[model samples]
Target: MVEESAENVVPPTKGGGKKPKSAAAAAAEPVATSEAGNSPATESKVPPKKEKPPAVEAKPFTEFIQQDYLPALTQALADKGVSDLQLNLERAKIAIKGFETAPECSQVIGRWNGGNRQFNVYFFDDNIQGQRAISCVDLGHRASTLEAFVIDERKVTLDLLVAGVVLRLNSQKWLTRN
Candidate 1:
């Protein structure tokens, strides 16, 4: 086998490869002169970066609560004979007026799986469900405690809402909190 040539090897940069060149640095490159002939420049030529369009700003969590989640959550609760519910827009939450023994007592906007999808999670003892979730059996379910189905935005139907309230009554601290 032929021995590897040291001349052919490129030195590794601190970033493990060619560092990204800024647009300003690329623009500051000297103009090539004809008299310079075929002599190579010290800096390696870097391709100009493509300019990207400004990203559209997305509406905030509270906006989602007011617009999408609140409507669905309100209707779901109302359909299940929950008449005293009120939406707290300032806090981006909802609570029942005359409810005793509130578990899953409040709901706030939350995301799952790196924020790929939007969803609502509940609060236990008025505690926010931030990064916490429960199993799926409580949607009109009785005694299937082993199969825990985490709440997701797509699965929060009227049936699940009723079941979730019931489940929240027996809410256990998340396994992680243990």
Candidate 2:
């Protein structure tokens, strides 16, 4: 597993954080006992095996993004003309479409740590006037404007994060940031 520091450790989900149970643990039907003249030669006792998720250590960030977050968030961001965003599965880095020409301070910012499997996203809007500047970061954007802050929950799923990000981007407050 990637080495996770406390700074990027997302809180664990409130429930159902463990892996799926093996089929034997999930079987619900009653089986015949020896008293019922059950013949070992004619009886089947094996249960179907449960599939396990690949180990995180194999590809820490890639698996999570490919299997969980991307599927849920891709369509939504595409609908907003922000498609083409790519998560560097190897790291917490990202590339947002249409940010190349924008001032560095006005571009979207994303950072993450694979070990802790947590990330933060920020979008800044700024206007420069005759050597003066005003920006969302300077104005003190609200807590909800942050993807990480909005995604805080005991049980955070990719779908939940997608919804939160979409909502924040579409809000009037965000639109008027500059």
Candidate 3:
């Protein structure tokens, strides 16, 4: 062996100049020293987590009708000897009593009977007698009987009632003008 150099004989650095322990070993070491120079309890204490609230759901009008009004109307029609009744809320019209009429007004009427149907009823005003004269059972019926009138005029309200009771009665809100 050659003569050792002064640089090679240098003393160790701080902490005895020995290589520091690895991350894993250091982490496993004690956070606090005991009275006797030993590690304290190593268990961690974590607080419990909070729970979240539930979400609310909103329903569409058509869904409300299907769930509520449709069933009730089906039953009511069955009780009234009406083998079938088609309601068009989109057009606000009712096709019943072998005829169809707009619930809004008497100006336009759609008639359906057996296989022959016509929509030829018109009125200058709400006055029932002023409408185009048609058979009470045909396309040109003038005065709509009380029952017929109510069916046309109140169909929407009836549908609403059915929907409200069966679906979410307190959930629906609307405004009507006569």
Candidate 4:
């Protein structure tokens, strides 16, 4: 009782093909009219299209801010608790008083508690996709300038640029938890 023989039924493509005909596509077809109707059948081949693997090539905002937005914003600010965490990607030629240089730039310097909480994402110009300047120093005061970008109108990832600097340091509580 093997049934399945109207020439082994196979004509359903042309839009109704969102992949739903598998028994491994009827065992990769060719079972025309058998089960002892005395052989002599064959013709139903359609299953051999699986070749898509070549599209991952985006990482150039200064190598995605030194390999994926500084280790995913230092693991999302060490999961919000933040500790020790001294991150740096510096490649400086010095000078960041108010920004405006390019003799070879790069900066990510982030210090921790002992340093009285600090920050400085500045990337003066290595074509870091433009506009980036943040400088914070919590417990030690100094907090006025802040502005960041790595493509916003078009949305670039790495979890939306580390959730826009962890939502501006969790809206200024500077990632609380102290």
Candidate 5:
């Protein structure tokens, strides 16, 4: 077998022979000589005044809410709630006939799998059906009791019954409060 030696290896060069100058260098160089029409420096000396574009008209809040926030909120509410109920995101209202007592409370189940958390909200007719299934792992750094409320269509109200913990969700990023 032939042995490899340092003398046979080619040494790296600072500049490869006869390589063309980079486009950046070409662009940076002067475009014209003294005899030409104008040099870049002279042309740029008295720069043309920039005219500002006309201001765009702002959309009304109601229009914006109807167009954007309403649809998303409506879908989220439907995904969370039970059947036979109508949810209006624009008005921030949920209409359900069976949720009158504690046992019939809406349940928002959440689970944490070390790296991430998954959660789902359900509307229940009875305590057994609506009871949230919270994992022990999720509650490790979280409060024993967790509370959340439906807010103005776009926002959700999440409150920890016990403080000093981190709560995370599959749909959202992890949240922490001291």
Candidate 6:
């Protein structure tokens, strides 16, 4: 009779139809002896840790427009050969004749070339994440107005806001020198 090795020995199954564990699987498994039989303890698996999202910059719209946007826009326009560009922040209604006199307007007007070239950005609300209407009169001619929303959804940072306005103006050739 041939001798059987301990590694090749198969554990008896209750139903007598279960497949025996292989040598590698039996060697890898932990041996536990209970009162009546051998049983493995339940595995406790720890879940993977989740990564956090980046923080957004929360700046007040009016403050950002006044303190950050205006200066950056001025420099950007000046760099684009707009030397006479003038920027004004006012609270009044949007009108050609009485916009400067209106008390409820939330707008910033940029005028260059002796008031002949002008564009006004009218804020619908105090939040940059909302809407803004831009009306431009290029060389005494009214161009089609467009609405702008928050360019970056993640944050309302100064650079993103300024870049949005500057890019819009640049794309429309609104601030280009003639």
- State which candidate, 2 or 3, has the greater lDDT: 2
Q: Rate the local accuracy (lDDT) of all candidates.
A: 0.42, 0.42, 0.38, 0.66, 0.35, 0.69
Report how far residue 67 has shifted in candidate 4, in Å: 9.9
Alpha-carbon deviation at 163 in model 3, angstroms: 11
Taking all chains together, each candidate's TM-score versus the true structure is: 0.26, 0.33, 0.24, 0.25, 0.21, 0.54
- Considering TM-score, which of the candidate structures 1 and 2 is the better prediction for this target? 2
Write the residue-wise lDDT of candidate 2 on 47-75 in tens digits: 55799985432344335556665655657
Any runs in candidate 3 off by more than 4 Å, and if so which? 1-58, 91-178
**Model 4 lDDT on a 0 to 1 scale:** 0.66
RMSD of each: 17.0, 24.4, 18.7, 16.4, 19.6, 10.1
lDDT of 3 by residue, 66-139 (tens): 45545665565345343434432232233335356545433333222342323222222333222222212333
Error of 1 at 142 (Å): 26
Q: TM-score for model 3? A: 0.24
Candidate ranking (TM-score, best to worst): 6, 2, 1, 4, 3, 5
TM-score of 5: 0.21
Question: Model 1, range 1-178, lDDT digits (tens) per residue?
Answer: 8776885454567865795555677789876644535324523464558997732212344454456556766666566444555544333222323333433334554222233322334444332222334332222222222222344644333345445643452353211132
The number of the candidate with the highest lDDT is: 6
In model 2, how many backbone clashes occur?
0
Measured on C-alpha atoms, candidate 2 has an lDDT of: 0.42
Superposed model 4: Cα runs more than 4 Å off: 1-57, 76-102, 114-178
Q: Which stretches of candidate 1 lie over 4 Å from their true place?
A: 1-59, 89-130, 133-178
Of 4 and 6, the candidate ahead on TM-score is: 6
> On TM-score, who's better, 1 or 3?
1
Minimal lDDT window, size 10, model 5: 156-165
